[model samples]
Target: MYHLSSLQTKAIAFLLTLFSAGHLSGQGLKNYGNNYRDFAGKAYYFGLSFGVNRSNYQIVHSRQFIGNESIKIAESNDGPGFTVGIITNMKIGDYFDLRMIPSFSFVERNISYTGYTNLEDNMTRIESTFFEVPFQVRYKSKPYKDVKLYVVSGLKYGFDISSKSRTKRLTDQIRLSPHDFSVEAGAGIQFFLPYVIFSPELKFTQGIGNVLIYRNDLQESTVLEKILSRAFTISFHFEG
Candidate 1:
């Protein structure tokens, strides 16, 4: 049998919690709209979304890290990001849909090494503009008047458009792969309006592949065995 990674499991749990809370809040809403009927018959719809994110790297230490003389602790620091995307949603059933969101995202990730060669702690910052596409399966609860609660699980592929790793040799900083794949999950609330359907969402993404481009000659790269990307995002989507 296939198993879920710890990150994937946590993402699922988070979404479930989100849905539970949102469902409760939705039930308390006294005013309801009949506008949902307009979208109920649509097979597909397109929309746009804007989001903000917090992103970081998940690092795994190598065996060599123990014996290393240059560094003691290597870890990552989280940074803020922004994203804009176009959403294409296809209805599959009364409560299910398939969705694709292709976005342009800007983020910065940092790595810090403690006790670096008897000097002060060293930090490396990597900035990226990612071309990200996520394909999602959405399960929405039956409408509660004008509001509906939904959860989505998906796989995303990302390529860093701002990466200079291809054009220049990286000697001072840790190098990363320009592209990666991730597993993601999220929750959202949809509100039917007169002109558009508005949805606000929370999402988590964890990379499946190691982004570290290991260089034996570099202590920064060698101190870590693997590097995975992770992000938490908040987005607002408008659909007609």
Candidate 2:
């Protein structure tokens, strides 16, 4: 079994309690009147999710890093990452909801730079694990009672819990204590059931800041690459 940390467990329990209370209150309100004037129709939901995140590094310009033998330079490319998290949703209106997705993700990137030689052969690798929180505002359209379509736009903040960099001449690994932010958008469909609600959503995230911590010339290798990370996710919700 996967044991959750104390903080994670507490967060999950809190979300569960909120959902349970909201559900009971909504039901009670519905029984009292044909149409509840207040957001009493509002409810909360919680779920577990796992997905893949694609990550890349944004180089500011061409630069070099001091190595044991030779100077190293490089560009960046997309790398595959993984994510797992707890999701919470709060009903905002008849056709809208607010969602919070707290997740732990492993992100990595490969940087290839031009060496002192004319041929571009130098490269390095940087990997990091992050704790991310995404807050989203969703617009849902339900033509029928059993089905709903939704679109969400959100912002995410990520804290670097672990980081390392590797190269040929030097294993220059630095631990960075920093956080990153990004903007995300996505759309998906939901199937509503009497017992549970199943939602499969796909989202895209683009980092707004530079991911590199070093002030070296290597940062300039790929200045044109603006996006730092991207992810596609599918999540399911169990309603109580």
Provide the TM-score for each candidate, comma-separated: 0.88, 0.65
Estimate, for each residue in 51-108, the C-alpha lDDT of model 2 and write its tens digit: 7655565444422233322335445666678888888888876777888889898877
lDDT of 1 by residue, 1-240 (tens): 012234545765776887777667766664556798777888998999999988888899999999987788888888889999999999998879999999999998889888845575888888899999999999887677788889988999999987776337546777898888999888888999988999988888889999889888888878789999998888999998
Q: Deviation in angstroms for 45 in model 1?
A: 1.2
TM-score of 1: 0.88
Q: How many backbone clashes does candidate 1 have?
A: 0
- Give the clash count for each candidate: 0, 13
The local distance difference test score of model 1 is 0.85
The superposed Cα distance between candidate 2 and the true structure at residue 84, in angstroms, equals 0.9
Model 2 C-alpha RMSD to native: 11.6
Candidate 1 at residue 232, lDDT?
Answer: 83
- Regions of model 2 farther than 4 Å from truth: 1-42, 62-74, 116-120, 164-177, 216-227, 232-240
lDDT value, residue 231 of candidate 2: 44
Which candidate wins on lDDT?
A: 1
